[model samples]
Target: MSLAERPDLMTTDPVTWDGGMGSVGDYIALLKPRVMSLVIFTAFVGMMLAPGSIHPVLAAVALLCIAIGAGASGALNMWYDADIDRVMSRTAKRPIPAGKITPSEALAFGMTLSVGSVVLLGLLVNWFAGAFLAFTIFFYAVVYTMWLKRSTPQNIVIGGAAGAFPPMIGWAAVTGGVSLESFILFLIIFMWTPPHFWALALFKSGDYRAAGIPMLPVVAGEDATRTQILLYSLVLVPIAVSPWFLGFAGVTYGIASAVLGAGFLGLALQVYRLRTGEAARKAAVRLFSYSILYLFLLFALLLGESLVTRMI
Candidate 1:
């Protein structure tokens, strides 16, 4: 049947299809749990690195709110992006695009969670964090997904600030305000975003082209994209080490940042040098994979050093 005639196929009853229980996994999938994990981790690291201590229960509530906020953003993003997602091969299997969840339902779910998270955080935690959470949702749903993604080649560059807000939110949860230290964490993620995303964009150029999304590789040539990726990586190296120079972090994080920064630059160079074929694809994938590892390791080291200092 044609797509137009398959209304039943397009509409999803998530409740009926999964026999009511819905499995723990499908619900988790709705939250974009993998991304949520990163949100939780980075936010936790930010909290740990910030001055002062929070009660464990308060900490738990703050993290829960952050996770819900992240999920809410993802659901809204999925809801809005579902159209292009249906067309893109990589995103076609997502819950909304696959008809496992309807767009309206996803939108409602996201809105509910968004409001609930902000309210609970404001009441149980602090308004500073709650405000940040609310802004994050607005930024991701309205600013990034709705406006920026379709409008410019610098979409990721600008939209990245939304993702970078998690650490600041977490820091606010602890200190009730933003600081240069928190912004340092934010800066690291911000600087890392373009290279990280462009690496994926390099290989997914076809999917983006088919979806009519003007990613770097689609608007600019692959060669230009590669050069931009290398340049961003070069800029990120020093910024990643800035926390150490500023005394928010120690020599341990500084050394680790320098090493990882060099490794990231090496990968970007590889991506630049590789020929435009399967080899280039492999290099892009490798950079994408390592980029995640690099960010996680950098934050993990920061958390570890903070813990060691606390113990000492």
Candidate 2:
């Protein structure tokens, strides 16, 4: 429903829509900066791994546009999810939910950034990359947040595409197209997302349940979520290791991927086995934490190897 149509959301009570100035930090908070950081890192790795080099200035611009697009997606998500964000403990402090920023303000901020980023990227970089970035924003803000997240347990499973597109977009920014190597990068993150999020869902099932989010654990039960985590981890490891086998990465990355993949599976196994009490929660938290590091290290390794190869 439109903000114009929802009286409760349009109140000038400061907590809802005061039409007052929010601090700069409140505006930044609407962007979900942590998630934007991951999007930036992965997209940079994709750029570095692409076959051709871009002018460093253009590359930086591309990354900036990507970061803005990601931030826009986050703001829109926060705006739309505000109602439920108020209920969930984890998100209750978000700018909109915490009364730091109004929903109308956030919507305007997101829409402006979303349009500006795509247009600038298209004009300054490449249209292909611009188009992909636009789709990523739409997928996250509309497809995942507006639809899947509220309606199905497979939310993360399908919505993961939004997060997984950055590398491909980055690759397109440099090469003006996609390739097998880029898709491998995409696939690695895509497969990793389910296990990563389901682990968080395992521990935060209560929060999801309270918020009516329909996360896998909240909808399917913990045992089923654990099983899915393990199953996805099994697929993720091989895909994470694939760039090495596919000739894009060197032996160092291969060894590191194998080691990292082992650690991932080990944590996932613990999450799967410890299904009750504090032990289970701890296991889930561990898996969730490690999953972040796992993806970062994988991309960091790929970026490092590509840079070294270029120098040699």
Candidate 3:
């Protein structure tokens, strides 16, 4: 249904959060700490790959700022989507919907982190990196969570850019600007996102429908989503191996990328061919699970290559 036909689908009634003090754990939940780990790892890889060395303390601070910025975006997303979250079984336990934290409090907390992260990064690292972090938070919180998610089925396709910026941001922290290598890192994540996310969307179509989200599977149906996933996976396989061609990675990374990319493509193909049932869910889940490992192993190979080179 078009939003115009069902305005209530996207609109939420006002919710008031009592200023009741929650535990530290509750506050951490508001930050979506698990999600922060991915940002930290990718950003760390980017920093390690940059051409020059930053002081250890400064590097630590930069990573901290990045984590906090990512957390702030998560908080803002929870705040804005609390209503939809309450209806969806998957997200119903999140801090906001569970009443562990108030939307107003989350807003204040996110804003504080967002500003603090950018300013501290600028003061301690460089203005360019700080600006980049600020933009990343804004793009994720405002652009993706607020604008794109409910508005279009292509939400993950475009919104994935917000998540892709971390490596570039990390590179900027060291080199003071984006380099082609860092962008390749960014592109890998950007392209991997659709296939990764769509796989989940396939299995979680019910949760999305309940929340009125326009996830690819929800909006376009299963077969279309499977085709799109296959198409993205095919394109992504080459991009995953491109770092080796671009000369930033070594034979170890090249070999790993080739193997992992093939696994990724094969899983995506499995998803495309399966019919709806336990078999279909198994394929989609397998693809989704392997996609995470694919990204981590690919980046880890680059990191390992760098370490061995330094020793040599």
Candidate 4:
């Protein structure tokens, strides 16, 4: 892109480059593999917790499909967001924005994977899971990326549902439908997303402003964003511990959830109470960093609980 097209990425006049010499790794980056890790983990937890038996081979197939479908969603998101991504420092080096992959190539790659994953999943596993996976890709690519992202300050708030669906899909893969158990898993992620992302948005308000994406921090101001974060964190604490209370998990999980939920609330409070200077930034960063670990550990406890129960 020329200087006019993307001064954020290009220091000089626009010059055409052949979208870089993409390697296997570059293509993988287009799939947002880092983001997929959480999705894959939560899906596995769902599959493990679900009440049913899937053949080992078929179980692997289900996971592969979930991973591929999630990757396709990421690829499509990158394709659609390339313009804004080029301007955001955090995303400026993504495959599309970095010119390692062309938009058309990304779109084609995403579409092909989307169709293949859904079709194979339906045939190999169950139609319910397959349909859910297809809807996830569509919701992320079209509903969230294309529509909600640029149009609303609550984009992440709603777009988070797309991320929340994977675990439910995994549960469906084994059980052939969703259950209350699967839905609580979904809710944990759903409630967690706003506070998690708003923390990053708090630290990166300039990026959203430059990209013209109306994130809560950009549209609602820092005070409002911080308040929302604390409120969400408060709500998330009880939900995080509910699996244990509801009898799907053990006392070990109850303790873990209680501790992690407390930490999450504490961090949110730090972000809310402390404003201005490096202290505020640090609070946001701490919350963002810990939020990821909090989710992983919460799910890990459930997976461990399930395994121990089966063994005993």
Q: Which model scores highest in TM-score?
A: 2
RMSD to the native, candidate 2? 3.9
lDDT tens digits by residue: candidate 4, 46-107: 99999978898998999999999999999999999999999999999998888778899899
Q: How close is candidate 2 to the true structure, as a TM-score?
A: 0.94
Query: On residues 1-312, what C-alpha lDDT tens digit does candidate 2 reach at each position?
Result: 888999987777766436676899899888889998999999999999999789999999999999999999999999999999999889898888888788999999999999999999999999999999999999999999999999999999899999999999999999999999999999999999999899988888899999988898887889999999999999999999999888999999999999999999999999989999999999999999999999999999999999899999
Candidate 1 least-lDDT 10 residues: 15-24
Tell me how far the alpha carbon of residue 149 in candidate 1 is from the true structure, in angstroms, after superposition: 0.7
**Residue-wise C-alpha lDDT for candidate 1, range 183-217, written one tens digit per residue:** 98999999999999999998888999999898999
Cα misplacement distance, residue 13 of candidate 1 (Å): 20
Which residue pairs show backbone clashes in model 3? Answer: none
Better of 1 and 3 by lDDT: 3
**Root-mean-square deviation of every model:** 5.3, 3.9, 7.1, 6.2
At residue 250, give the lDDT of candidate 4. 94
lDDT of each candidate versus the true structure:
0.91, 0.94, 0.92, 0.93
Model 3 per-residue lDDT at 192? 96
